[model samples]
Target: METSVLLIEPDPTAAQEITEILQEGGFLPVTRQSFEAVHDSVTDEMPPKAILIGTDNVKESVLSFISELKADPSTQWIPLFILSRTNEDSFRIDCFNAGADEFFLKPIHPKELLARLRGWVNRIGNFEESAFRDPLTKAYNRRYFDLHILLELQKAQKNDYPISVAFIDADKFKSINDNYGHHVGDLVLQGLSKILREKTRTSDLVARYGGEEFVILFPKASGDQAANRIQTILEYVRENPVAEYEGQLRHITFSCGVAEWKPGLSVTEWVKLADDGVYEAKGQGRNRVILSNLQTSEHDHLEEKKKVLIVAGKGMSKSIVCEIDSLAYEIQEWQQGIEEVPPEICIYVIPPTKGFDAGEYEQFRMKHLPKECKTLLLTENHKALDSFQIMATGIDGYLRGPYLPGDIELGLRRLTNLN
Candidate 1:
């Protein structure tokens, strides 16, 4: 693919010169007249890899535009460069302060400019790739999947496109690890990652979510389509050996669940739906693929399950219940102030709200919760900086809001080891 560079040059002659220079240097230059036109021209589907602003002087307007570009999440990742006639220290400082990744003085040699541009672009690309990839398997890490899924969800919602998620787990992986050793376990993971990368389309993203578990993001694919593809991979895995154990070729199998995006599903909920399919596949005997059968509005609703006590403001409690309902976990809301709840409670969800007191909640948890039970606090997003104070209260985990029920589900699942 040709690398794209967005060039914002007001002077027509300078713009033409820069365009030619970028093209000759092996970049596809996207020229625009003003900063205001950037938003209209650039899109999420095809954002510029880098940006270059060529100007006569570093004006306050340019600084503001730079700040805006850096603030917007979509464009913030692109490397931004400022080219000016003045090499004044103050102008250079101002550009850096406004989030310019690089500053170049005019009359710069074309080779030098291209070198700097290419170097910065490659540096950013390598840094981002390293941050998003799992070191062991070379697959996308959980953090990448978390951010990417949200973006895909937003795009699917806006463009009325289909997006699907496949939650994959190595069938009986624990036995493999116990019997073979961590070395063979690592080999199996690497082999699975290789197979997924080769079998899936370029548009698909393969991510190692956690211990023996992986997820694939299928953009523009429906649940059925994603499942069929996973089925093919499953058959391939069953037929091929992934690793050698004691001079014996050992094969692996995957249990997969596929869930397509719907009109109103949060990131967690969408992933949870796919996860439920994995659970179903495991239940029906592993080494198969299952598509989520539940609707966006319906949760598994298994009332015979253990209980989760939700203690928050009335509105927040109701919202939590609505989100948790899909996971089929029994919910008991105690918005009137968590004075008391049933003895069968396995999880406690308390959000800091109007009547919330961290100290009080801590005391309640200490007095009531068994070793097998865990407490998760819900704090506002801004309160993340004050996490030390929140954690000092001795909660098992804390979730930052604005969050969906699926977020709660994911958190609780992580803490499920407490039992």
Candidate 2:
């Protein structure tokens, strides 16, 4: 592989000469005319193996760049050099103190430059990769993620490939630490790391952003794709508990939010969007993936009300959206399955006229009723013989056929104690 170098030199004449020399020495040089463009160019797929700066004077911008570069643990070890016209004693000392690996007074000398560059490149290549990883979880640390995500966003825009970031926050993590000592919490985190690694693609990145908060970078994936992937992880964790101790099974669940990349958004804004998703998921409940784009439009729904999700057949789930009083609850309709992401009350509409058999409606309700969510049954025909059975199926309330909007609110009030 050709080692890449970030060459920063505003002078085109000097930049071209250095670029050609570096190229001849088997190095791939990515030249940026300004410090601002440097970040736009670097990414996980194209990190510079070394940084080369050419300057006639030590300006504030140059000093700031070097200081910031050294401060970031990700870029700190990559070799840096200052190529200048003056070899003044004070200037040389300042450059060395500012973290430049070497200071050179250059007219031009390709042979000697190549020798030094080669040694720095080799030294960087041999640096322990473990320094970029979180020791306990064995996942890439936040520093690795912070830099790679910025690059991935730039790559996505340039290559016209979709990229997504998912924020995963372990639900009730503090409770786990409190109930089961820190040792078991550590065990659970380790187990979660194993699952995340196993679930993501080899090309994707899995990083422990911080304690109980993880982030995943999905290259060439949309927000929907990221949400689906996280949903799979949610289901797997649900089925398999992370730890078993003292005759009790301990499990950890996470809320995930996925944000797709859009051009012109900064890295901080991109992460904020994904973090908003995680916040929404956790707010709804826990153990679910919520895509920012999937939210109901403000023009169509009300805000700051209890959320009601209706999961039923095609036409059956229709009226609930229109009939729901926005003052009582905010409504979202799902055609196939119940939303595990919190629902204050679920209304399962069963139309007997649609040819669902006598007992089939009860079975359907039993299957789709979310574990913790209160459920209300609105059926057009089950009022006949299934009335007694309906009450016993764990449904909170049942509305007979042809119910009015007033009746809907009444049932909701009864179940949720709004009255």
Candidate 3:
């Protein structure tokens, strides 16, 4: 399929030159002589997938034009590239700061320009295939839910955080489709999706799970806590009616089943537990939320209470002990100056101290560390070490500062799947 590009060049000669190259490259290129006329010329039916702005001058008006394009809600999300003859540092910086996905110098190499432009358009198309939204309801689809569920599981395992999942099904939905047309059924779904989006916390994720069902992931919430929130949604659905069909207002209620995520639990198992909860909710009645009765066996508790050793200088080691003590693990303290590492400890924490060197620690670890173990290091700051230096050491992770949350946590979670 030919990708459409909106090319804006103040100079007619340059616009005509680029237009021919785009046509030869099999792109449907629309040329405009003025940036001010861009929005008006491109109507909703024929909106370009991306826009390219080219000019030799780097004036405030040029920068303002980019800013104005960004400010206009219709043009904001569309990819925009800036092409100019001026390659000054300030000019490039201002263009990107305003909003330019790609910047190129003038005297365009037609092949290079087309390759780069097509690359961005193709990438956006691939991403849209795996896009988060469910077209019918405007909620996230199961793709987004599955991706986040696994991520949240890894985080819960690493950081000892609580997470919950709920499976929600609209009661007697097929009857609604049978009585009223599928059109009304779609409206019912859209209405329910809006209610779920508005009612849930921003931290929570709600997704459409095929027909008549939806799923939600509640990070940092237990099953009971998830149940509490679902109760309110249940009440709201009861109070509200969906659509007016045949002079009668149609109403719908949902049944929800909630389960908490646990350490050592696989994503499939976690989802199964939630599905089981839905089964119970359906068995009990159609319009209720039920929390699954799950017991943490002695084996599970023992796993959660796994021992973690901290190896560092006295000051830093003790500080790490304090931080990790907040978690479920049993803390074992070891002075970094010690000759040997304890064999039994599988997980280790090494918080930063002044004058510590990662290069030297790489050598020390080879000699004394156990063959199979997890090591988490804390550097001076975010920029204390480059990613290659951090990665070269082959540690499991870096510690997140108590104040600056999420950076290390998210980075480490991503690193786990690289294997």
Candidate 4:
């Protein structure tokens, strides 16, 4: 199907000419005269792929309409272009500030306008696809899983519909990288990804979160149903070879953690719980599935014993030490530039500019931080939060700079309760 374009222009002659030009250029153009008509049309029908507003001589009404469209979620994703009569420098800044995707001069050439419109249409389609797909697996990724699973979780909370998540990790994956080349390991990963895509339903999401780990979001699936699915996949992989490298078959096994979505739990909380279940499976011995809930009090009790380490910088380290000490919990503190003492909770209070190396910190978090331990990163820099979030190396909570002793206590308490 051809892309749709909404052309908003008050001049009848200009609108007719543009409509003819767009149709000839292989687009389906819809013309409207006023902001109210465009608003009504978008509300009653699907939004156009892009909106072209003629700001020929900046009118307050037209500017207001553009602002309104940009603010509305329903129309925010639509690419917007402005046709201006003013000089490029003067209007270019204002047009972009007003959320225009592209700006064109008045007496627009039919060919140039069509080319720009087609370019934007292609860009938007690519953006939408990238937003929901895993970069590595080419499967529906976490963004889609979060949106769709949250909706299902809400329904489960209201109507008692069962929903669960399974966290899967390749057993002894690091050894594979150590024994075979990383290239061979990557081939195994790709083969496993293909098998997962073939086995799962279109409704399910299989996201490759990071190295050797994946999450499956299952809506309307009970704990038993989730475990059964994961078990089937495990058995299939064990029996079927993924890759033949170095004259030997590469077989893969996975450890799975299953947790049913609970009422009044946020999406983040549900994911954490499922991840904890995965840790439990790994602890019990790899290549198994573990489930947790109120009904499984033994599992819950075992989970509480998990430890966390809090690593703090020089300035905030003292504050964290003082706070945790007052709480009557014995915590070992590691000073800046010293070896981090292995603790259940590691608190880093280092300054933003002097953050730890990414690869080193991640190795510490994964190897030193206990399986149950969570890391609380307390820094004064917001940029550090973005960096750690992207790395996703088990830094659970972040506190900005100039924090009070109470803030440190609160962060520790939250992390403790989460564990």
Return the top candidate by TM-score.
1
Cα lDDT tens digits, model 3, 1-419, are 67789998988899999999999988999888776657655433357878988865547878877765654433555778888989789988878876688888888889998898888888876775457689899888876675556545544554566889999999999998998889899989998998998999887888998998999988878888999999999998999886666677878998888988765554555677788888888898779998875676733533244355656555445434433332334667655466543433323333322433677777767766676656666654454566676688787666533322223323333434411
lDDT of each: 0.75, 0.74, 0.71, 0.69
lDDT of 1 at 140: 94
Model 4 bad stretches (over 4 Å): 1-78, 81-96, 103-114, 121-164, 201-204, 218-232, 283-285, 294-419
| lDDT of predicted model 1 | 0.75
Q: Which residue runs of candidate 1 sit more than 4 Å off their true CA positions?
A: 10-12, 40-46, 56-61, 86-92, 243-248, 296-419
Q: lDDT, candidate 2, residue 150?
A: 50
RMSD of 4: 13.9
Give the Cα error of residue 328 in candidate 1, in Å.
18
Model 1 per-residue lDDT tens digits across residues 1-419: 88888999888888898898899999999998787758745555567889999866348888878866754444667789888887689978988876798888876578988999999889978997898899999999987787666555655665678999999999988898798788899989999999999999987889999999999999889988999999999999999987776798878899999998764454556788899999999999998999996653474441245567776555456545544543435677654445554534434444333334667666766676655566776755353435666567656776765453146666766666421
Q: What is the lDDT of residue 146 in candidate 2?
A: 62
lDDT of 2: 0.74
Using TM-score as the measure, what is the rank order of every candidate, best first?
A: 1, 4, 3, 2
lDDT of 4 by residue, 179-247 (tens): 888988887887788887788776566888678888887767888898888888888999998878879
Runs of candidate 2 with Cα error greater than 4 angstroms are 1-131, 244-249, 294-419
Task: Report how far residue 136 has shifted in candidate 3, in Å.
Answer: 0.5
Error of 3 at 82 (Å): 15
RMSD of 2: 24.0
